[model samples]
Target: MAELMEQSLLAMREGAQATRDTGAACDRIGSAFDDMRSAAERLVDTAAEISTFVAAIDALAQQTNLLALNATIEAARAGEAGRGFSVVATEVKALSTQTRKVTDDIRQHISGLQAHVTALVETANGVGARLDDSRNATERANRHIQDVEGAVERNTASMDMIAGLIAGQKDATVKLEEGIASTLTHVSASEIFANEVVGAVSATDSVVKAQFASLEAFEIKNYVLHRAKSDHTLWKKRLAGMMAGLEGLRVDELVDHHSCRLGKWYDHVADPVLRNHPDFRALVKPHEEVHVRGREAAKRYADGDLVAARAAFEAMNVASTEVLMRLDRLIAAFQ
Candidate 1:
């Protein structure tokens, strides 16, 4: 009887050991299931993140489309002057369309990934239901979640690069606007200068007409007699002074000095007609008494003569109307 009792006790020990082993197996299966549940949750989060990224991409694409449309409208309003801009606008529109297409494609890819993830999660759940544990499945689900996160990070980086490119384009557009403004300003200045030139020419014409009228009314014989006598007296004094200064000077030196003085006189006479007048023309000729008188005067320190040079220079500084009249006559004859 004692032998039978010992054998029953041994059998009871074996059965307890088997029960403990089954309990340990169930615990491992439960841990695996817990891990799978956590992985599924992580995958869902990743899908959510991707969805948000896709939505942001969509918003950006829409903004790009709007900007392209605005550019096109502006180009159209600019007419023929904006032909270059219009071409740029068309290129921008095409780029926007391409961006939209890429965004749509990304959206579709994300949606498909989400769908696949959902199906995977459902399959894992089914496997968990049929299996005693889900530890291995949970680990696989977690790996998928990590892959999805990596994809999201890449997409975000791509979007950032695109945003930076757009900002650069905006800067270029601003510079183009500034260039157009400068061109308009230059065109305006040219028009103003042209108008001023026209007004100046008109005033000159009027002055010349007035001067001609004045000359017509003068008594020619009386004027000639008076001018000739006054010229002779002035020339005699000038010649005497010049000869005295030339006591030690050579003929060539005198001639050079005289030529320079004549050039200065020519510059002093701003009015071409006055300088070329018949009376003044005859006086400045080489070998003439008047020319010799001027050369002689240059050798003397005469206050009166210095005063005359200053007066001549001052006379040239007249109103624009008078100067323009002389310039007009010169231009007309040349033409």
Candidate 2:
């Protein structure tokens, strides 16, 4: 039981460390996305500038067309003597018409490109926002884990104190037994000491029970795995909600494997023999794949690739099943 408490505390600390690393990774990702969005914005601005330049060319084309029309009219008034000028004016007007058509085509293409660039910016911003939210959630989880670690430490101290007291009582009881038949007065004192020993034993049993109960309440293996499965389910549901136009769903809220309860337990398996168990070793790969696939699904969905998102989600489900199966086997081993 003491060993288990120590392992749990170690796991919580390791989990906290994982969260900090995750937070750092999130910051890096957010920075990259910010750079990407900025570049996209710059592209949008460049597109706008190109569109403005095209518009100016379009206006110039229209003005040239008008001037060519006036030239054609003047050449017609001059009749046969201006025939050459009339032909030149007609060619100029045709050229201007082609110029306007070409400018219109360029403007249309620019508009489409600009629209796509703006959408890219929006997507990047959305990703960054979600990352920030995830980071904040991770930090909160880390703080809570730290609190749990502190509590476990205090409980360990209390358990150690109780164990020491129990040991002292055992020693006293041994000495009392050695002199039990020496004298009546000694026997009487032994009786009182035996009563005291019984009370101490009872108290020790209560303390042990209480400590075990507290550990049981953690529901270690099965409970952690069950909650992990539930967390994944909730993540998928929230992602689906977001895809369905629901508000307040953030893909970043989905935690990575290491920051999860099961992950923590797996990382800090203090029992060397258990750590080498086949099921325990196999569990990590599937567990990690589950989180990876889940994140991929969320990212694909966020990027508006519904088909890919569904495929990734299906993969995640498969991995999650494997994870649960392995976890079950591992739990059975523990039992």
**What TM-score would you give candidate 2 relative to the actual structure?**
0.49
Model 2 over residues 77-170: C-alpha lDDT tens digits? Answer: 9999889999999999999999999999999999999989988998998998899899899889888888888999988887778878888899
Best by lDDT: 2
lDDT of 2 at 79: 95
Per-structure clash totals for the candidates: 6, 0
* TM-score top scorer: 2
Q: Which segments of candidate 2 are over 4 A away from where they belong? A: 167-335
TM-score per candidate: 0.34, 0.49
Model 2: how far is 329 from its true place, Å? 81
Candidate 1, poorest ten consecutive residues by summed lDDT: 312-321
Q: Write the per-residue lDDT of candidate 1 for residues 3-58, one digit (tens) a residue.
A: 44445445555555555555566567767876887787698788789879877877
Error of 2 at 136 (Å): 1.7
